[model samples]
Target: ADGAAYERALERHAGLAKPPGSLGRLEDLGARLAAIAGRCPPPIPSSPAVVVAAADHGVHAQGVSDWPQEVTAAMVETVAAGGAAVNAIARTVGARVEVVDVGTLRLGPVPGGVHDERVRSGTRDLAVEPAMTIEECRAAIGAGARVAAELIDGGADLLVTGEVGIGNTTASAALIAAFTGAEPAEVTGKGANLDHERTPHKVEIVRTALARHAADTSVEARGSLGTLASLGGLEHAALVGVMLAGAAARIPVIVDGVITGAAALAAVALCPDVAGYLIAGHTSAEPGGRSLPDRLGEPALLDLRLRLGEGTGALLAVPLVQAAARVLTDMVTLADVTKTA
Candidate 1:
């Protein structure tokens, strides 16, 4: 972020007809956009696109989520067909939704428009073994970077992170605990209407995975990639790559729910600079999502108690993001409003 550009934006904000800080976070959001675009009045973000990265998690076998592993592939198909919540929200916001199959098990026929970049059919159960090989994890990250590049190259001015994978919240909780030093019980949440009776079991599963990768889980250990490879799902790794690419491109990437927040944890771990490029679209109902904004130094733009992981929450916040820049560019200045005495 450039300090000069930010100061210039603040100056412009003061010059606006409204009182200083009248718009609150909106004023701050505009200034940040100016810093991001390297100008006092940043260009309004247009042509937003949400990339839905889909995969199947081996943790599904651990009885963590009530939804079966097959639902991962089925929902990927729904996203590809533009039938999912992300699709409708993207449509409402005039953003395109791109579904990518990073890795899914038992996928019969992939619908058109969904890119096929499967790292593996599905990750191995993290409780018993590492979810993915180091190479596989790297490849998945590379795939996300490629997807971000393609979308930005295709004229997408902003990127939104979305993920679809059954049992992914288990992986997310484990990743959050690993990165934030939060207890598994504190970060874990009941996913997919998981019965209260089994929530503690899910927490234990995350604890087990974190314990298995204890050496690599510490932030000071400088083992972010190691931690991801050991416990992350393909979609999570890809989201990290996407975030890195967005930062490299200087495009804002709005993060979705707990699943996306987990990816963000890994991304910020790998490259702390990526934090400057991220936007917390909402505070997810999940405990992990609730804690992520503070870690990223950005407050959530909305709090819809959203728990869906298909980028739905992020997509809903697109208009607000666009509004921030629009206010800077379109609002009247005090000089314009006041006539000469």
Candidate 2:
């Protein structure tokens, strides 16, 4: 991000017709948009896009979620057909939706309209072994970066992170715990409404995975990649790639719920500057969702108690993000009003 542009935006906001700081977070968001665009008056993002990275988790076998792994692929097909909540939200916000099969298990033919970038069929159970080989994890990240680059080349000015994976919350919780050093019990929460009876079991599963991968995740190891390979879902790795790519291009990246939040943690581990490019779309109801942003030092823009992934929460925030930039570009300065008077 351009620090000079950010400072200029803050000065411009103070000079706007409205009282200083009256716009609240919108003012801050506008400055951030300027910082991202390297100008005091950034262009409002008109071509926003959301990349929904779909994948499956071997941890489903651990009974962490009530939803079957098949739901991951089924939801991918639904999103491709424009029948899912994400599609509707994206449409409402005038943002395009792109679904990528980063590691979704192929029960049969892959659906049309979904990008075929599968690094593997699905990840192995993290509790018993590494979720993916280091090579596979890197491949997934590359796939995500490629997709983000393609969309940017296609004129997408803003990117939103989304994902569809049934057992992914288990992986997300594990990733959050690993990066934030938060206990599994503190980060883990009901995913897809996992029954209260199973919540304890889910927490235990995260604990077990973290314990098994302690050496790889330790600070002395400096093993962010290894940590992700051990505990992250394929979609998580891909989302990390998307964030890194967006940051590299100086574009804003709106992060969705806990799953994408976990990916953001990994992305920050890889490149701390990625944090400056991230905008938390909402405060997810999930425990990790709330904690993840706090760890990144980026407060969420909204709190609708949303936990359904697919970038729905972040898509809903697209309008707010666009409005923020417009404030800086279109709003009149206090001097204008005084001159008119």
Candidate 3:
């Protein structure tokens, strides 16, 4: 059913006015997104929601990230104050930003518009222990799903998943490896500009954590919250739930960089069909991020050497998607292009 819907969607757009294939990949994005919604002129999500999940990670103590743990909360504050890149980009695209605090250890009042669903103080250090307790992980997933469902039910036609947490990318890469069965080195990256001196060390730390938990992860199934709790961040777990909800709601989700990608990978593992709702935003410059999902054949939309995990890349591609949707919706049929006798 999904494949057929996507096929006719592409066919309809390609048959629209203007030269065939003139609109390039955009026509494709629109057609696929529309098929996901199973509607012509699928809702453009006039007020698309960018759900930014913020949490702290004990892994930051492992020297995995160049920035301090405080940066996570500080940046969340900046995002709420409209000073972050996602804030600027979402504004340009007319999308609303909603920040969620899944497990910021020192959480206080978030901005009025942000959601506070703190499941725990923060995740445990993966280097010395699992990032989250199985129960905490479950709650985070439920929180994320609930957020996405609420946004969709409130008429958000599209959802862009984003995240913030200084050391969360380290958590994301670890999840990608354990879930995707890829090597830790293959999924780890130079997060937040880890100096050349520290990049390798950061990667090694992830490696050690993986080895210590090797038997546990191998024994776990990536298809449930337990798998996530064993090797993922609170934010990632929540994002995975959000993706699952978005898929069920027939909303297209623009996945951010490595962190968001990690969440999407877990979603795919949990519910393979949820991938239909995801649009690969861009290729992350994070070390092996580009190849993280080599098993999935679709290529990313952009590659401007971005390693940021703030969903900035997804926001950057929002216009392309909107433009594509416009093409499908506004284009006249080829038959209509001819004058009547």
TM-score of each: 0.96, 0.97, 0.92
Q: Sorted on TM-score, highest at the top, how do the candidates line up?
A: 2, 1, 3
Index of the highest-TM-score prediction: 2
Off by over 4 Å in 1: 215-222
lDDT tens per residue, model 2, 1-341: 88899999999999999888999999889999999989889889999999999999999999888777788899999999999999999999999999999988886767888899999999999998899888899999999999999999999999999999998989999999999999888888887864677889999999999888875554533488888888999999999999999998889999999999999999998888888899999988898997657965767999999989899999999999999999888889999999999
Clashes of 3: 0
Clashes of 2: 0
Off by over 4 Å in 2: 215-222
lDDT of 2: 0.91
Taken over the whole model, the C-alpha lDDT of each candidate is 0.87, 0.91, 0.79
- Give lDDT for model 3: 0.79
Q: Lowest summed-lDDT stretch of 10 residues in model 2?
A: 214-223
lDDT tens digits, residue span 4-44, model 3? 66777778876787788887888778778777878776656
Q: What are the per-model numbers of colliding residue pairs?
A: 0, 0, 0
Q: Return model 1's CA RMSD, one decimal.
A: 2.1
Off by over 4 Å in 3: 107-111, 217-224, 291-295
Maximum-lDDT candidate: 2
